[model samples]
Target: MATLILAQKATSLAYGPLVYAHYLQDHESDLTVTVEWQDVPEITVGGDKTNVVLRIGDIQVVGAANAVHELAIMSGHASQYTDVADQLPHWLDFTRNELASGDFKQLGQTFETLNRHLTLRSFLAGYTPTEADFAVWGALRANKIFGGNMKSGGAKLGPHLVRWFTYLNGLPCVAEALKGHQRAVESTRNRVDQGNFDIPLKDGALGKVVTRFPPEPSGYLHIGHAKAALLNQYFAQKYDGQLILRFDDTNPSKEKMEFEQSIVEDLRLLGVAADRTTHTSDYFDQLYQYALQLIEDGLAYVDDTDNATMREERGAGIASRRRDETVAENQRRFEEMTRGTDYGLTCCLRAKMSVDNPNKAMRDPVVYRCNVKDPHHIHGYKWKVYPTYDFACPVVDSLEGVTHALRTNEYRDRNPQYEWFFDALKIRPVHIWDFSRLNFVYTLLSKRKLQQLVDEGLVNGWDDPRFPTVRGIRRRGLTIEALKQYILMQGASQNILLLEWDKLWALNKKVIDPVAPRHTAITEQNLCVVNVLDCPALPEARDVPKHKKNPAVGIKKLYTSNTLCLEAEDAAELAVDEEITLMDWGNMIVKRVQRDPATNIVTQVDLALHLDGDVKKTKKKLTWLSMLTPAEEPGLVQCMLVDYDHLLTKKKLEEGDQWQDYVNPVTEFKTRALGDSNLHDLRQGDIIQLERRGYYICDRPSTTESPMVYLIRVPDGKAKSTAAKVNAPPNA
Candidate 1:
């Protein structure tokens, strides 16, 4: 267990660390912390004494900031404390230098800055709280002047600050920390409960609740499958129960070992570890016996109705001709099916639940089908007849001791049929809970459609950036953390919603923005060369932070020379003597412009350094790369920046609409660009930002075989103009 030593009469500066430690102990099961009070004297304002000390085994940390950092690291939650890793030290310094000042005017100014920062964001660093919040909140709570101001309506402290403070203060951990070893007070604030994420199961018991994720091993797991798997894992962990990963591999013609392996790998990537893995085929013999029992009990019959007529009969609420077949004859046909006889190849076993039930799903649903051609991937021709998902699911779930069957609402109509099997077999029944299916507008979640796209070469493969598979989105720059957080936020809402892609990508932006390294790339097409008249004769190089707000992301070498390259679009908008800011560099004035007289394309321009000019006053902020100097030429790295559009043009397809008719004619787009020298060091999968452009992931690095580096654009969940666009051809 981790131990935290604090002064008996701790000061406000130590409360943040105390609260953070308590939070870890409560939320992180692996980390157990015991706080020990000591008789150490409280440090004065300018004293050089540590108020908080944390010890984990042999690791010891002194001071409030270090203690929080140590606890976060020990609990495997350092990311929460370092979301703004680059600027954390600067913010920590602000808490010490400004907020700790005795002057009331200086303290007010500090609060004003913090209030404005919180205006558009919930936390100081990222979407979630960081060490900056912990330190700042502690400093503010310690100040008597700030406390008095908040008590007196907080008019002078600013409303945003007050709102943020109240929210943080109400948290259970924070409340407990303030009470100093006392029990936490229950929150009384009324919040708009959008939907309950923590869904409680009927008769759910700790260590006994069991859940299962049954995926058909026909294709790669898509985002929809991801939601189901995650929810099952979430419930299982919530109840301290076992989670089973079961593959519904009854359809051998479509299922494959490769797909099953991929599903396992994807689940592992999503942080879902099943307690046990099994296949529906593992109980084939048992299922066959169950079917025989149903036939003997006259609960099921053999039907030879053709595919078209069977659908027509079910739709018209008409009984099949074989509905009254004798039990002995049905038993003979089922035995023939198991033996792969040609006569039984055309027959299927159906449950005789209803002839004209209001619910069409109960109208003699097919329970067993004959497949004599393709050998089972696992069983390998051991049996010719296979039980349908409807017959196999409930039996296997009960056999595996699953207590709750969490499934998508699309199966809600068949819930009764599922329970019917349990009653017909006189076995244990599993509770059924239906949550809405995850559907994205303009996206296809059907495995058959996705496979068609691959077979026709419409996409690279399952991992194509345009596809919605788990691997596809990850390649497209969607972090696993962002995906999990987004899904959990949706929870188990019963109301089905056709969600837009922007909301998910927007959540991803919050995760990657703070850490993605920054670089510069100028479009190679119609590029204009600019001569900086006042530039130094020789090239100058300086090391600058890759991410402005995050110094911990490290630095990149930026070079400046007399000649620079600029995108023609920015040049065309410039007027004679117009002032513009050159991104990382200082402001410059456009002195001259030269264009191709025939096409009006920008060809060449002249600029003069205006370092003293106010960058805020400049209307245009452009990205430029230095080309050459009097000493030597440092050529820019060549890159192919690729972007994509939705696979389908339509936002939402209707029931009868042919999806192929709505397929986007030009979903893939490419643009040639010249990037900064720093891009040359980028390896595959490195996510970086091209200044004035959006984020991108390195798909391929420059090699002897392929000279140009390949970078795929990452969506920023912004308007079309701000993200990657399809202004050029596929190979441009």
Candidate 2:
């Protein structure tokens, strides 16, 4: 390998050769040339500013007049360094030029496109440093340094690329380069770190608020956890307080590195990257000291009673024999327990709270447990003892300077205990914010249940669309904006409620409908044959918007023919001479209706133009497809027109009732359909509202060329009140 050395300032100029080499290699050209180092210009511009010159190696090159000042070395046979100022470079330069010119509109779009392709975690060459990574990083920082209207454009540059960008940006190395770039920093801020924290200053002065998102990495985070993360994050950002992401991985048995990593990823995905991401394990020594201080202060003790006996003793409002153990004995046993020498035979650490407290969690809960097994995930058999999450959480929060502690209402009872730990340890007080947990119907968010489903193959995995996992929802075409908006709508409330699926799906639709592309399909209808009056072979119709608002979203132009087909139901009641409106076109007349004699069902329909000049009045205009010019061949879609009467048949099921008996037989209906060519191009996970057919997502792509499988639903169909329909205004 030879070297092409350029000065540090000329690094940008070196980009051309490397890219050209790669491009040539891609084309299977093995042409090799050695580039030796020499003095070069700091910045090189477009060709035509230099003169012919030859160097010591007889390399044919041109030297520009006054180019020495500009570092332009040219060759007589000099080929323009076309590679340097090409498409990718032009985009980069356009971004830079736009930033300089203050044309933010164009700059924002270009940067958004670049951001989609570049990310921090991405490896430069191949998961490691490469010239491309560094170059892209430099250009991206310009947007950050010189402010612009920054927002994610819902542009996805593939998962590997996404993960790469995320990882690179999160690295401690590039953090310095990202300084002064508020948008970039905010993008990386952790969700749970937002909170109102008040630190106490000197002379009885109150300081600003700080908060932390402390997640126990024993299971995957659900929407409830996501809500807490976002609330804390919002508060932190609002208050300008430090947000910390701490892993309360105290119990090693259930916790794993996998969960820890996923918790970090989940937080990042939710736009929650705290000011600092620290772990409880990182402060084990301090936590241990705190525990010892509580024991020494006579505020905690070692309980040697077995689990069943201890529960019985606490429930009876009686202190166990171990509770009465002297401080010296308790301290000795705690040490022994920590060593795992007398673990099972010895005692566990418990905060000495009231036995008669109504809340079971307050009744001297155990703060530490001993286990001789290998470390579960991170520690990996390194320690024989672990602190409980409840015990470690407050300690770490205070130690990390966290001001506000936020969690779901489920922990309301334990809030006092959290306070007790701080009081007993003589630590600073942290404010607590309680909010309701989110519950979605038809899905279980319990980790154990989800794990069972995964283990038993009831669902695919964590990312299974059938499951309510974050990745699952994302894969199902739900956007981060939608998730944030939905959670915000739920608001922070003390009142706990079981959220209806209808409301959640409605919110989801609201976000996705405005921008998702529109394609046409119908259930129970195999083809749409549009009848035209000597229709042109190729009719050019502009793409129709999925949404009337939002012009940035793209649409498709559907072609029509003389024998366009409409849904069976749409054709069912059509009478001769009746007028029906075509969606994109004007009115058409129902010339005739054909029915199958054996089945006695509407089999087909014939139609003629119900031109506005002739038709005076009409009702129920419907959509149709032209059979003469089918963009996509017939029968390419397997449509499921899903209908759910209720999640449960009965209004409510008794505790012991056979609820499974109420499973709605007609919960879903599947049929075949002829879709446009554009519909055939829909990838799995694309959500589309079939015209008058309801909203749906493509669950699986078609194995054959023609038809795809679609899972769809009609909003508010089952829930719509008949009374409301009867009383509705005429137009509606």
| TM-score, every prediction | 0.72, 0.62
lDDT of 1 by residue, 1-732 (tens): 788777655555577678887777777888888877655465333345667778778876777767776777778876654546877778778876888688988888988998998898888877776767877787787788999998889999888999988887888988777676542211211111123558889999999999999999999999999999999998999999999999999998999999999999999999999999999999998998999999999999999889999999999999999999999999988888778788888899999999899999999999999997898888888888999999999999999999999999999999999999999999999999989889998899999999999999999999999999999998988889988877876788888889877768888889999999999998999999999999886788888999999999999989998899999899899899899999889999889999999999989999999999999988798999998632453357899999888888787999899999988878887899999988878898888988878999999997768769899988887767223233345756
CA displacement after TM-score superposition, residue 338 of candidate 1 (Å)? 1.1
Give the alpha carbon lDDT tens digit for every residue of 1-732 in model 2: 222332222323332232323333333233333333334334232453221222334333332111111121221111233343233344334423553444556655554555554554344334443334434444443334222222342243334444554554554435432232234335333222232233322222133667787777877777777888888777777676777888877777677778878878878888887888888899878888888888888878987788898888888888877776778987888888777885544667898887889888899888888888757566676667678888988888788877777788888989989999888888887788777788654446667767776786655577765556676666555667767777776666666766655555666777667666655655444332335544465644445665556667666656665656677677677787877787766787777677778865677666676566333355675766654444444433444443223323444444586644543333323455666656656677777766665566676666576454655443422245101222232210
- Which portions of model 1 show Cα errors greater than 4 Å? 1-195, 536-538, 629-634, 721-731
After superposition on all CA atoms, how large is the RMSD of candidate 1? 16.1
Give per-model CA RMSD. 16.1, 23.2
| TM-score, candidate number 1 | 0.72
